[model samples]
Target: MLITQCQQADVALLEEHLPSPSRTSFHAQRFARQGVGTSTYLVAWLADRPVANAEIRWNGCAATEVRQAVPNCPEINGLSVTEPLRGGGIGTALIRHAERLAVERGVQRIGLGVDDDGNPRAAALYARLGYRPVVRYLDRWSYTAHDGEVHDIEDPCVFLAKELTSAPTPDLGVRVQ
Candidate 1:
């Protein structure tokens, strides 16, 4: 197994191997482009094929809104391992790789979200990796619903995070949950 920063040439390979959410070409391009200039993504391969992937972002997106609401937080983006290889530690490898990159980039902490019931396994995996849940929210219609009316769903999505390196000047905005 080899872990390396993703390249444009590796995009199609990643698309062919990862599952639905991680397979799109646009994201592959984004990751390859950003990982190069920005150092935000890392891809894991086995036998020369993409098997797992993760992204560590300086900011949070919708999944990380709760943490953003809190204060200071470093947001982590997509983290996934191909379904067929789930129990084999690919996810852990990808996360650890992201951690190394995050630490190198001077980030003090990192955050990510686990989808409601839909991704329970991912939540458990993150917990095993020392991530703690700091916030929870309901997921209404997901990409198309109002926050006010979205409050009733029992979706229970969770935001989890881990402190990477403590900064000399504490950014007391938020602590990873």
Candidate 2:
């Protein structure tokens, strides 16, 4: 897989693959954030198709607890891989790519939130990637769907953080689509 910053051109591929609210005017929205240096949205491609996505929020998570605890840490949010191809190291590669990008921007740490009660596999993956639990809270957020329907989500989650050093970028040996 080739990991790179998301572009407007990738929107349709993401839509056909993941088909979620994340694509709700997100091409332009992500571009705005990227242009202003506030966020970086990354897309993972396999065979010229988008298979995964992640975002780096340089200001840290918006949640009050996460902001208070790791103020300068960039949070890696909205990570998702296509369901059929998950478990193939695509998610890991995306995360490492995000971390490398963060280090390039002078970030010393990073974070991501996992569903506390429902996702043991994701928690384990984060643990294996050197993230440690730092804050536990009930997170609430809302999103507008592609069809103009708004949805609210609440989840019990733990935010995991990792200290980033100036380590050499790994040769993930990704196979691009």
Candidate 3:
């Protein structure tokens, strides 16, 4: 699978391949508005079909606890994989790509908030990926939908973080004279 930053051309592809009510287009617009290096919308493609997607926000949002814990860290948000393809490591790939992007931007840590009461599987996946729970907080946010309806969100959330470190270069075995 190839993980790539969402491009204008990929927007329609995402709408075609991903589930309905998908936020891929919304995220793509946000990425465009925020410009490169500030925000990102990533898509995981399997054989040219988008299978999963996620976003990274440099200016953290919501998750008051996460901001208190790591004020300068980027947060990975809106991680999603197609319902039929959840267990295939697409989510993991998206996360790792986010981390790599963070590291490239000179960020030392990354954060994300998982709903404690909604999806424990996501929390478990974050734990397995080396994120440690740092704080618990009530999440509160609101947004406008395409249908001109405003939606409010409030959930019990756990903020998790992982410190990023550069990987050591592998040494090729060779005989030295």
Candidate 4:
């Protein structure tokens, strides 16, 4: 599996596979317009087939709970792994990728919101990844569905955060005399 930033070619490929009205397409376009270090779109591929995706937003995000809790921290949003590829560590890789990007930008902390009521497994995963809950609230947002119908979402959510620190350099095990 390979994880990389979405390129122009990747955008076209995402549009073809994911299409608009899906969050994937929306994030891909945002990445194209905003570029890296601001809003980055990442795609996880398995031998050329896109298997998962996530976005790191430096400017801000729609999750009011997370924004209010960590105003200056970058947020990871829209993390999704294809149905058949779930539980294969793709989501973990995407998250780590976002964290690495945040560290590169000198960001000290990162935040994300999970639907606690709807997806307990995801919440568990975040906890296992060292994210601690900071806030709880209802997530309300509106989006146009695939059939061109507007939909309103109001899910109970928990905001989780983790501090980003540089990894310790590996020791070569050489003792100097």
For each candidate in turn, the TM-score is 0.71, 0.89, 0.82, 0.83
Off by over 4 Å in 3: 19-25, 34-37, 145-147, 168-177
| Candidate 4 TM-score over all chains jointly | 0.83
Instruction: List runs of model 2 lying over 4 Å from the truth.
Output: 26-28, 145-149, 175-177
- For model 4, the stretches where C-alpha displacement exceeds 4 angstroms are 19-24, 168-177
lDDT of 1 by residue, 15-52 (tens): 67763332235446557547656436667777778777
What is the C-alpha lDDT profile of model 3 across 100-159, one tens digit per residue?
778778888888989987898898899998999888888886666667677787888888
lDDT, residue 61, model 4: 56
lDDT agreement of model 3 with the native: 0.76
Instruction: Report the C-alpha lDDT of model 2 over 34-104, residue by residue, as the tens digit.
Output: 77889998888887788888888788788898888878888888888888888888899988888887788
RMSD of each: 8.7, 2.3, 6.1, 5.9
Pairs with steric clashes in candidate 1: 71-173, 72-173, 72-174, 132-177, 134-177
Q: How many backbone clashes does candidate 2 have?
A: 4
User: Weakest 10 consecutive residues, lDDT, candidate 2?
Assistant: 168-177
Best by TM-score: 2
Residues 27-138 of candidate 4: C-alpha lDDT, one tens digit per residue: 5556764564578888877766666778887875566666777788777877888787788777877887788778878888888889878898888889988899998878
Candidate with the greatest lDDT versus the true structure:
2
The lDDT values for all models are 0.64, 0.82, 0.76, 0.75
- Candidates 2 and 3 compared by TM-score, better number: 2
Query: What's the distance in Å from true for residue 159, model 4?
Result: 0.8
